[model samples]
Target chain A: MHWQLEIVFFIVLITTAFIALDVKNLLVAVVTLSVFSFISALLYIVMGAVDVGFTEAVVGGGVSGILFIVLIFKTSRRSSD
Target chain B: MTRKDNNPIVSLLSRIVSPFIMLFALYVIFHGHYSPGGGFQGGTMLAAAVLLIRLAAGREISQLQFKKSWGTPVGSVGVFIYFFTGFLALLMGGNYLDYSFLPLGLEAPVTRGWGILSIEIGVGLAVMGILVAIYDDLLEGEPND
Candidate 1:
């Protein structure tokens, strides 16, 4: 069961990572990156690194996501690349 | 471009919610030794709580909660605290970060535990301050400039 859950999380993590890179809209990309962080945190928790998982969830998903969104607001929404 | 958000719902809800988040952050920091959370997670949560208010309310109003200028200084102080703790151990005839010699009037293990707790607090404060400072800096200047 744990292995199955880990596999599912890995799938979601990779998918979000690719979407975050591929998405043209910067805001959507930021949101996708947040999702990626969340999944990675879950993976860490499953692996029993609770402290690392907690930090990843709060810092990576929460603070970094907010910072990225604010960055998007301050700059252009559309990516040149 | 620090504009006050006019949405009453967001302002009201965040105002109500931020304090609880901060309380939880403190809990996480204090209970880190026995739990999954620690300085970094708690500090980020603390910063998150403050930023929630900043984003929901306007920059001006949020300043009442946490001044914009306080971030970097608070972070500096936290780093100082960590360094001072380590230096104190060195002065007391131990290696750097050797908390057993802290002269806290406790058993060696307990002294080390206290030392770890103090270090976690310092790290938490530093993380909170730096993260908030980053947010403040990112929001500076005119949007679309």
Candidate 2:
């Protein structure tokens, strides 16, 4: 059961990373990065690194997400093609 | 890009929720020794709560909660606090950050615990201040007027 969960999380994490990189819209990419952070946090928790997991969840998902959105507001949203 | 609006529901909800988040962050900071949380985690949480308000209500209004100018100074104070603790230990003829020589006349372990707590508090303050300062600086270059 544990290994299955880990495998699923790993797969999702990789998927999110690729999506974050591949997405042309900066806003969507930022959101996908937030998803990646969340998955990484979950993986940390499952591995028993609770403190690390908490930091990843809060800093990665919460704070960075806000910062990125704020940046998008300040700059252009669409990537230069 | 969508023009940012001060939505009523967002402002109202954020006002109510931010205080709770701050309270929880404090809990995490102090309870770190017995729990998984510590200064960095709690401090980031504090920043998150404050940023939520800034994002929802606009910077001018959020200034009432925490002024824009206070971020860097507050962070410096935190670092000073951490350093001061070590300096205190040094004044007592111990090595820097040597908890056993803290001025309090307590058992060695207890003194260490107190020292650790103080350090954690300092770290929390520093982290909180720095994060907020970074956010403020990031937005500063843009002409808001």
Q: lDDT for every model?
A: 0.89, 0.90
- Candidate 2: residue A80 Cα off by (Å): 7.8
TM-score for all models, in order of appearance:
0.91, 0.93
lDDT of 2 at B77: 90
Docking class of 2: medium
Best by TM-score: 2
- Per-residue lDDT tens digits for candidate 1, residues B1-145, read 2453387888899999999999999999999888889888889999999999888886777899999999999899889989999999999999999999998999999998999899989999999999999988877775421
Give the alpha carbon lDDT tens digit for every residue of B1-145 in model 2: 1345557898899999999999999999998888999888999999999898888887778899999999998899989989999999999999999999999999999999999899889999999999999989988875541
Total clashing pairs in model 2: 0
Which pairs, if any, clash in model 2? none
Error of 2 at B79 (Å): 0.2
